[model samples]
Target: MDTSRREFLKGTAWMGAVAMAAGCMSRQSAAAGGASGAPMHGFRVAPMKRVRVGFIGVGARGTPAVKRIAQIPGCEVTAISDVNPARLDAVQAWMKERGLPAPKEWSRNGDKDAWKGLCDSDVCDVVYSATPRPLHCPINVYAMAHGKHVLQEVPGAFSLDECWETVEAAEKYRRHCMMLENCTYGEEEMLAFNLIKKGKLGEIVQAEVGYQHDQRSLQYNPRDGVFWRIDRHMKHHGNYYPTHGLVPAGRCLDVNRGDRFEYLVSMETKSASFEAFGQANFPADDWRHNAKMVKGDINTCLLHTAQGKTLSLIHNVCTPRPYDRGNLFMGTKGIYRSYPSLLMAWEEKVGDGGAHKYFDEAKAQKIKEEYRHPFWKVAGEIAKKVGGHGGMDFVMDLRWAYCLQNGLPLDTDVYDLATYSSIVELSERSVNARSSAIDFPDYTRGGWKTAQPFTVDEIDMSKFGFTS
Candidate 1:
């Protein structure tokens, strides 16, 4: 193995042990009662006229997020940290080009913990991290502990203990900790959410969601030099990337609000597709050919909610196939499915037996326009112009800034982060235990019962000069 791979394995082994110990302690605390800290449901802070933001790991995701946040009216990128100084320089230059002040840099310079300095500094009101998976929890906890709100990449926690740690930290610190689940901000997803809120789907009974993108080339690209994603596939099993689909699905069902996931059962197919891809693409002597891919080619996890709702979550990164999020929602009076295309069917009357067919294209378009989310209605054009992941990234960042600027409770709070991220470890446990059902921790301490459902309130685009 290469030196970096050897060091990564060693570090991963140590982290696994630490995670287990932490998990045991957290469970013990839960058994006694609950976390010592208060719950962060509907938590809000004083409004900031300009929310100063610090960024860590300004690579692919962070770079675009920084640019988008710069365009937002109430956000100021104050600091950026990364191991690569070149990335910092590039971002600084971009800021200069945009006539924005260059952010202070916290480059590695032989210290891998350089990002901690950014979190500790008082320059930023919030810290956003697009770091590797292992660093997500640590950055979140540390940033919140230091009195800065945190915005982290998807699957915020790698293990159950990390999930608990983030929740406790946010609660104890009284700061917003939100997972940057951009998928929830997608135009289609927002439209679906609006329809659900408007009773178009009736009572949602089940949701089918999954991340099924073929990432063989990205994972094993020679030019990229071995991504950490492929390393995850080698080391772990069961839904390593779940939030892309789960967050949007959960939002439709009011997860961690009116309902919470109760238990999960997961199963996986044999691991062969990744290895086969490596063999077919790379040389016989390449590291990919020799690496052992332990994770299954596909993992499907079913979750039961406290309200008796069901969710089907799937994860598959290997195999050559068309990209799909597998977003399908089944309801008592209607159904919405988006894979090959957007499809919906609903009954005009309860049990009238007229909901057997989907709406035609023209009708569907009209309904979509009528029920379009307010955020899209106001900022859709600007979002489309800025553009990232079909403008969802911009919407997500814009909403983050708007909430902070207005002192509104975040659409997705700490509990959502904990509940959604806990799937990574929870699914792994179920898979390793021969598909045995594993109970989900009530990270909200039963607060979900009274939490309000997410709403699609319209923003005044004129305030940001986006519309008149």
Candidate 2:
């Protein structure tokens, strides 16, 4: 192992020690139901008939999400807010075309902060924000403060402080706040989750997951609200879009429940490709061409879990690589990987050739069918019918609504939002400090020790209306 990896292990060991000490110190207070500053609470609101949703940022992502949420039977898209009037008008027109009533518009003409008023309004029970990275924390905090549940976009917040604040607000206000990490809802991931629960992959030791898409055009395109993404790339130098793969990996590893992320070390490749892409695509006089990106073309982050499991996260959005999340889960008994989507389990399943071979398409299909998750069995077809990112987005929306309507806790709670998103800030700190180990915040306080692992089968789908 290299120095950085050694340092990361040491840092995680230190964090584990601190966590134990903190838990010991707070045992008495926790037993007495003390209001510790730590996020030691859950979101279990009273059961409601329908969940009314107010949308903020109806741009590229929000548009599809809004439409999907509208299709969910027990959810209402009651209000819409956006900085751009044209986008608001477009949403309203689209709703009208769908034979749905135009939602109450909540834009303040040119105010970028108009979403705050919508959050404060009683028009909606939930605030669905697909805003830029910097705005996630503020909007979520405000929404929760005003008694609205939140389903915000991924990498829940931008900075460590933002992560803490988002968690604090959610815990303090007793509202469900989930990061919309739709990738976790993918079919294969769900299958992996079920297999993990079944011990098909015995005692997961390590995994690799991340966003590896070449989003160069989308990043620098001024038309698609890429300016904000570009700005983030220019300012940050770590795993900016970590949640896409991290969330699914965490679910497999049982993060925030059985295994908490302890610490991470990161190193980044030089930022040459994006600069070259910019020069080739944009005009010589354009700032996008001349300006240099601070973020490297690729970032690799290694995280240690409290349970001694490890996670390798890769972030590369500017490169010319084909879209890949690199979802490779390993264990004592088996391994699973995406890209071509294959799995291998103790040579027994591979038919014992005295050498390793991945399961062929037919065998893999059989395995998936045999171990298909209960949640997918119930919701997959409808999700596919509704369609977003191969139905994962729709599945996420459905699950959120189902949980809220049933008064159950979210799968990806505030602690999840904080811990997963913290990689953005922590990895940068690590890379800038010569790949030093950085301690992860225990946003769950000491609750992860006893927190119940979320089982997909435990979800009460009978409470949900799955219209075909």
Candidate 3:
């Protein structure tokens, strides 16, 4: 199973972009969605028949997103593009197995310059952008300007300006732009979000969340190729990856358009390791990668919601601990923690409302019939039956299809992405300036301070005091 020439070239492109030679369009996310030659979201006043999807990266995140999205009812994965030519081999295999058309792939061989143009071709109505963090803004801006909806991977874009440009392009072009923060669809997070929305967590006063999986080994592996994360560590500080942990927590907390997050402070620990173990394990040809990255450690950001609620956010990639998302939410009545037993409270004896009283007789009996995180309420047997990242992945894929089917704004949009990601991009400014409170930019620079929270057919979060 060696890479064919085309595959090798594509892989090289992916590595180049991922390696920072090109700047991140390799590992973030990519997918084929909707149908071909149709309008996505606000393309036209009248609805288009389908949401044709073109995925721009078939590597790690894109592959899975494509695989799962293939299960969507009306979506047609029209095309794919990647720096890693070899990745198409896998895409071809998977598509064949599913009895679908093999999408045309853009590679260096086809035309070194064709990858960017492929995004704007008549073949797709939307582009699922799973490129690296740095490339997000450029690719998204390009796609939106060219009249294509974009579903970018997490953290949306690396810089605040980039975030602004991308979203501005989206609105200007009237294309739907969604930052695919899948963790929000995670069963536990969803359950927590719904519980809070349902008023289960009475008046959330404070919360905690993080992206705390120790990826030290993976991030430095030569076999894993180069990554833009190195650039962040080598040149920056503050919350490294905030969107994954924050989006879900923010959803439950309702930190949106006007319900904004005020300025806060951040503190960091030490760096992981200066030398690349992967480069050390490999040959002199990889010597270019052996260098000291200048990022600080264990990013801990404390935030104060406009409503005076408190939040603790952590982002760490270099640690030797069991995988943990570090989610804990405290309201006037109870609290919720993600790991080490997934639930917490001030003792069930004091239950004013919410999932807290599921233990007490009076409240538990009344709420017995409520709908839980559609997939997570019962993680064992039910999640196993439905499959797909314990069902959150399925939820994400399904919702995209559902939105396309109904012509609605996506569940997670550009504003939500900025709310969560601006923390990382601006935290460095905040920290370097001695924890000076950094003001979040209103990219909507259009009257978004009064914008509405995104909602779906059945999910309404206002009941829990999110109206603030």
Candidate 4:
């Protein structure tokens, strides 16, 4: 091996907690809640007009996100920052081709920290960051400190310390700091959430959610100018990307609403596929072939809620398998599972043998349509047209714009970001301790006791000049 196994294992021991704490200790006090006539805990912009947006990290995710934001009526891409000048130039060229004015560009200018200039600039009302995991907290804190609301990518923080910093920064700035967890807005997932909210699930007992995609090609490819994801896989051994599944699952379970995640334990199978790929793709003598990998091929984490409910979350990226988010909810009266959805319920009907059975396709479709989330029913068409992750991503962007325009609190708040992303750090602690239970932090500061449960409230279309 290029490095001793002990050296590789030693890398995981450092939490960077002290550095994070010292950095946050000097930050200004949390921002006060909104003034009268403003939405709760929201900072309202005067005479709300088109929201000016600044984007950082315009690579694969940010490129498409900027395009989707440009399609929204009340959102304008005002500024962009990227370490890759080619990406910035490409996006500017695309805007010009589409007859939209080019945005101000913030280049790295020999400083790897150039994103800070974009965050500190006055050109944008909302700062959207799609940077790698390590940079999420720093960029967001800087953005909020500069009085800009933030729409950041998923798994917003990599460690508990970073999560705390995010929560404190958002509260202190009194500005919106929403994680862009698009899965929560997926058409089917939103419908499931609506059913859960209406008590159709009849007290969810256990739920299973996962990011089970076999996209090793993306993970192994280093030519795209960013190997951060690959680097994370090399250095960590826990559920790294938890938000895609955890956020929606948490919302359905009403995490941090009526219930909060109490504690979690995780276990993993030995790593194989990544090691095999390195041997086959790289030179035999190359260090890549011998680099020590700590990540498990598949990781399973079980989390219990304060109400005694459980959430089963799995993460698998190295294996060859079909793409599946593993959205499954088992309730007292019924159950729902997706990837071409299937529903079985005691309420639907009984089988000829006098047993509860699966609902017929037609009946199930009718029920889903009936309970279909209002947001999807009203805006699903536009979302499809705008088109990101089968419209869910676009819907998320438009909703962020709508909330900002109307001065309403966001769908996924700062606490949600911290709690869901906490799984990353917490799962690491659990796995390293031989699957010992790790307690979840109550980022809400005891507010979960009375916080309102998740809702499927549609955006106020009229505010965005839409007449749905």
Best by lDDT: 1
lDDT of 1 by residue, 296-363 (tens): 99999999999999999999999789999978998989988777688888998898875788889888
Model 3 lDDT, residue 394, Cα: 52
lDDT by residue for model 4 (1-468), tens? 223222222322112211221112122222232221122223344534678899998987898888877756667899999888888988898788767888988874636788888888888888999877788999878998899888889888878878877787776677788899999999888888888888766678999999988767787775564678878888888999988877888999888888999999999999998888778878878766766678989999999999999999999988887888878898776777766465645443333332156778897789788987887876776566556788799778877787777767678788888888888888888899999998887776567877888777887655672322
Better of 3 and 4 by lDDT: 4
- Candidate 3: residue 369 lDDT (0-100): 34
For model 1, what is the C-alpha lDDT against the true structure? 0.83
- What TM-score does prediction 1 earn? 0.92
**Worst window of 10 by summed lDDT in candidate 3:** 22-31
Question: lDDT of candidate 2 vs native?
Answer: 0.79
Give a tens-digit lDDT track for model 3, residues 1-468. Answer: 223223322334223322331111111211121112222222322234466788887777788777756544456788888777777788877788667888777873645345577676888888998876777778888888888888888778777667656655665677777888877887667666766766656778888888877776666553347666666777787876787778877777666645667677877766644454445455666643465656665878888877788788887777667777767788766766757545544443454344433254444323433635643432223223334555566567656655665555677666566556678767777777777776666443323355564341342111111112
Instruction: Provide the lowest-lDDT 10-residue window in model 1.
Output: 13-22
Order by TM-score, highest first: 1, 2, 4, 3
RMSD of each: 10.5, 12.1, 11.0, 12.1
TM-score of each: 0.92, 0.89, 0.79, 0.87
Q: Score each candidate by Cα lDDT.
A: 0.83, 0.79, 0.64, 0.78
- In model 1, the clashing pairs are none
Better of 2 and 4 by lDDT: 2
**Candidate 1 wrong stretches, greater than 4 Å:** 1-26, 30-35, 108-110, 222-226, 462-468
